[model samples]
Target: MKLHAADILVIFWLGFLTVSTVKGSVASQIAPRSSCVDLSTQQLDIRNLAKYEMQHIPVKAVMFITRRGIKICVQPDLKWVQNAIKFLDKRPVTRRPTTKPKSKPKPKPKGN
Candidate 1:
């Protein structure tokens, strides 16, 4: 393969951009650390098991931790799940509020 200075520069630039973008995406995905609600145990549970995924249950006092690879029920984090529910409840539901129409200004008369 013929090596060229321009080719190396282009590859380096592309790799830098890709890394930066991935970092930004991962940062955005992970919610900022806040005292709002604690879920330390839940997070550990998510990372430890190879085949497991957590799902928040709003109404019920339990969080589903189903196995991923084999797809089976593992265990429910009732207490932590409840805390998650509380956290979700505290979050504000953003919706555009309806408002009445405002009167428009009158048009000025044009000179003949």
Candidate 2:
């Protein structure tokens, strides 16, 4: 019973493909039923979200929009979570900037 390099590669690929195709994954089964979701901006409370999670209802992660308009998901209980909430609360929501449109003229257009 000897395994070679090619045997190891085949075994790895087989495991990867099997895991990818399986509908019920080990990770999904192990998700904590009582995770936190803190949406302070939307008046959504943490306790309410926890209740939903405990009932096996999927609670989406709390997200924030950065200056660049990139959406970032953060865990509620992180040390910096409170600070981030405060920061976002204090700032006004601005229009998300889009990718540069192809205009043949001004490199830095001053027109608003």
Candidate lDDT scores, in order, read 0.49, 0.53
- Report the number of the highest-TM-score candidate: 1
Please give the TM-score that candidate 1 achieves against the real structure.
0.29
- Give lDDT tens digits, candidate 2, residues 61-95: 55554444444445555556555565555656667
Which window of 10 residues has the lowest lDDT sum in candidate 2? 47-56
Candidate 1 deviant stretches above 4 angstroms: 30-112
Deviation in angstroms for 10 in model 1? 0.4
Q: Write the per-residue lDDT of candidate 1 for residues 17-104, one digit (tens) a residue.
A: 9999999998889653211122333332433233323434322223323335323232345554445445555656666898979989
TM-score of every candidate = 0.29, 0.29
Look at candidate 1 and give me any clashing residue pairs.
Answer: none
